[model samples]
Target: MDSANIVVVSGLLIGLVYGSVGLLSGFCLLSSLRGFWAEGDGRLVRSYALAIGVAVAMTQLLAAGGFVDIGKSIYLQSSFSAPVMFFGGLLFGYGMVLSNGCGSRALVLLGRGNLRSFVVVVVLAIFAQMTLKGLIAPSRIAMVGASQTTTTANSVPALLAGAGLSATAARMLAASIISAALIIFAFAHQAFRRSPGQIAAGLVIGLLVAAGWFASGYLGADDFNPVPVTSLTFIAPIADALQYVMLSTGSTLNFGIVTVFGVFAGSLATALLTGRFQLEGFQSPRHMLRSGGGAALMGAGGVMAFGCSIGQGLTGFSTLALASLIAFAGILVGTAAGLRGALRVRPLAAA
Candidate 1:
């Protein structure tokens, strides 16, 4: 097959694994954090830690091996807007709480016949598009421009090498130390040890992130018209997919769009196979209102940040970009606020 076809097939297949594993393992970062903070359960958090670990190790290895040019990806850009990323991350994190899931989680739940997620997905996609290139574009771009930081190098190893460390030493040391720390933390819990499914989910999802880099960077790459180098980011692609749906006649297929479709299809298929398929909807109009608002925030914020939880948290984090770290902190803070403390938003009493 040609490179385009290869990219399509690879993305679809990887997305299938992502959907299946996500459904099977219930790998929602929001849920994991809630479980840890609210219920004193750390197993799910540990699972997420493992995913970061595996993704970091594999992705860094790919960068080192020249299988992928990490610098070519957006996560490793020379400059980024820290303020936009933080604010966007905060919006996204709180939205995840309000919606009870992230973008990828909503897709998976929608595949299981949840109509609530349909609203979330639609609103998120539309708003994300708005922030990207619609009415909100000007303001968004302005903020990003005003808040931009022109970094010397985006990735940790590159920065380290620029300081003093040798290139190879920096890559190896940075990847090994960070990955090892996360790995150790993930396996530190006995609960995680007993739950093998979570471990599998972490490993598979992390590998999928690396796989995404490979597919988009190498397989989809064209000398004449190259595809963008990216991995498992949801916000922009969700919008792109929505556009593709409306303008299928004029639009071209992309790795991210195909992957989004694959996630839904994969989840749907898995739900059917496992007899977990069920149709669900909002509990009331109030619930519907909450979901809609949440979705809008997620879409807008994700665009401002240039990624969502999975986008920056997993994919961007894998690159160890300083911007990702800032976003990560913003997400955590927002999540904390939403889940508890003074900023905690209670469900509205029925009108």
Candidate 2:
């Protein structure tokens, strides 16, 4: 009934929608890129592009309508460490390929009874916590402190406003240009257009991101107990969820933690109802080693970057923050390294 409760409920519902859609549509950035580059299938990537486009448009609209103060979100911080964020994205991107999925994807797979994903989720959470508040925290803090820079313009819209455009005009112009570009790219592919399922996935997922902003920013705007404004992100939340499981007495429930649980539950229910639940595990010790290492990288990198793929790629990007752009670029480069060129991770031999 209260603002906090509204946010909690919204998080759960958002997670449920995301999980269900993810399971049904196989919506994942890594999978999309891999399919495009390796298999020459552009449908998945197009879906991702469309999602980003829609998210940017809708999120900006909310900000323009005074429904959300997106400037308060982490992505738009005036001071940021570009080097650290970029490098973190690189690590996360590479780790994603090695692990065969990102955090959200791992959660979905875990719900489908993939024991390998179970390992990935646990290890990723542990390392994410480590990077966030444990042994790795000091080093991460040092790196950020050393390289951080402050700027008047932290987002594309802000930059445009600085260049003589009115604030409102700047926001609309920047959002329109970027969103239109991505949408055009997405729809240019006839194959993607033909896949109504992927189109729906993109639209729904993008809308859910805006829904997240509305939930935390508007609905949860309490005078005395204001909630932190956030959208769909998995890295720190997964870590926090793990911590909550162990320290329930001392810990408090937040949107991120609840969203993690909701994602698992939604995916689990979907898997069972769709007859897709199947037990699976690593083929060998080597496989386990690779998966664990990748998860660790993702955890650490995601923290340094301040988000995972869905976190930065979609949610952060939706704000048009310059830092998100840098991180997203780093992720793309890292993914490319893992998927192609000399640094590409070769597939393991069949056990």
Candidate 3:
């Protein structure tokens, strides 16, 4: 197949794997955190830690093997706005709690016949589009503009190399240290070690991260007209999918759109096969209204943050980009605050 076809096919297959894994594992960062803090479980959180370690290590290996250039990705941009990213991450994290999951998770749930997720997917997509290039652009742009900083060394290895280490040495050192730490943390829990399902989920998810880099960077690379170097990010893709549904005549099929569609299709098939497909909806008008507000925050915040949980937290973090670190912390704090009722979004939990 040609490069364009390669990208489309790769995205569909990757999305299918991601969707199936998401459905079976309940693979969600919010659920992980909630499980640890609220439900006295740590298996899912450990699974996340394992996914992070694997993604980082494999992505670095891909770069080392000359199969992909991690630097080409958006996560390693030379200039970024820390405060804007933090604010956006905070909004997304809190929204995950309010809406009960991130955009990707909502898609998975929607596939299971959860009508509540349909509203969330619609709201999140619309607002994401608005912020991306619509009415909300001015304010979002201004906020990000004020905090933007240009860095000579934007990523971890780059920064270390700037500190006088050789490029290869710096990259290896950074990769080894971080990956080892993550693996240790992930497996520190005995319960997680015992849970084969979560462990398998983590491994598959991490490999998918690397596969995404290979697909877009190597498989899709064209000398004449190249596609954008990206991986499994949901925010912008969700918006693009929405636009595609309405204006296919003007739109061109790309990796992101294909992946978005594949995710829903994959999840639907999984739900049916697992006998988990069930029609569900809001408990009341109040619940629906609250979810709508949360979805709005997630959409706009994802745009500002430049990603969602799996976006910045996984794909971007795999690059070891500084912005991803800041955004991840912001997400953690936001989730904690929301879960603790600090933002007054905990009415349902309190009762």
Candidate 4:
């Protein structure tokens, strides 16, 4: 097939792996943090850290080996609004708490017949599209335009290079330091090390992120029709997938859209095989309202942030971009606020 087709197929396979791993191991940032801070279980969070470390190492290897030019991805853009991205991440993080999950998690849950997640996914998609191209677009654009700045040194490696390190040396130093630190943090926890399933999840998910880059950057690099080089991100892709469902006659298939479908399918197949598929719904109107509101927040915030948790946290971070760091910090802070402090989401009393 052509380059576009190749990339689309690759996205499907990657998404399938992600969905299976996610369902089996429950790999999610929100869940990880909740488990760590609330329940005092650090294993899940360690898995997430390991995933990030692996993604950074593998993605950088691809870039260094000339297999992919990740600089072409959105994370490495020359111009971006740090303030806006941070605020957006903060909103998304909080929303994840309210909804009890992030976009990717919701998709996995939906595959298992959680009707509540169906509402979350639909509302998130609608609000994301609005922020991207509907009513919220103008306001988002204004916010970005007011604070966005252009910089040649948008990444850690580039910053090091600016500080007198050679390009190759800078890249190596930055990637090694960051990846090693994350991997160390992950394995530092004995509980996490013992959880073979979580470890496998981390390794697989991390490799999938790099695979996404390779699929889009290398396989889809057509002379006449190049595709955007991106990895596993959910926000805009979810929005695009919703639109494609509505406008398939006029729309064309792309990597992100297909990946979305593949994730759902993969999770569904796994759920059925494991006898885990069960119908579920909101407990009360209050629950539905909170879930819907959270979805809306995620949609809009993800648009402003240019990614969701996985989008910015892992995929963007792999690029070692300064903006990703800022956004990631914002997300962590927001998550902490929701998990603790006065803003903490108290557990619902039994009905």
Pairs of colliding residues, candidate 2: none
Which candidate, 1 or 2, has the higher lDDT? 2
lDDT of each: 0.89, 0.95, 0.89, 0.93
3 or 4: which has the higher lDDT? 4
The lDDT leader among the candidates is 2
**Each prediction's TM-score against the native?**
0.97, 0.99, 0.97, 0.99
lDDT per residue as tens, model 3, 126-165: 9999998999999999987888999988889988999999
Greater-TM-score candidate between 2 and 3: 2
TM-score (C-alpha, index-matched) for candidate 4: 0.99
Give the total clashing residue pairs for model 4: 0
Q: What residue pairs are clashing in model 3?
A: none
Worst 10 contiguous positions by lDDT, candidate 4: 342-351
Candidates sorted by lDDT, descending order?
Answer: 2, 4, 3, 1
> Which pairs of residues have clashing backbones in candidate 1?
none
Worst lDDT 10-window in candidate 1:
342-351
Put down candidate 4 lDDT per residue, 249-332, tens digits, no spaces.
978889999999999998999999999999999888888988998899999999888898899999999999999998888888
User: Model 2: which ten-residue window has the lowest total lDDT?
Assistant: 250-259
Candidate 1 local accuracy as lDDT? 0.89
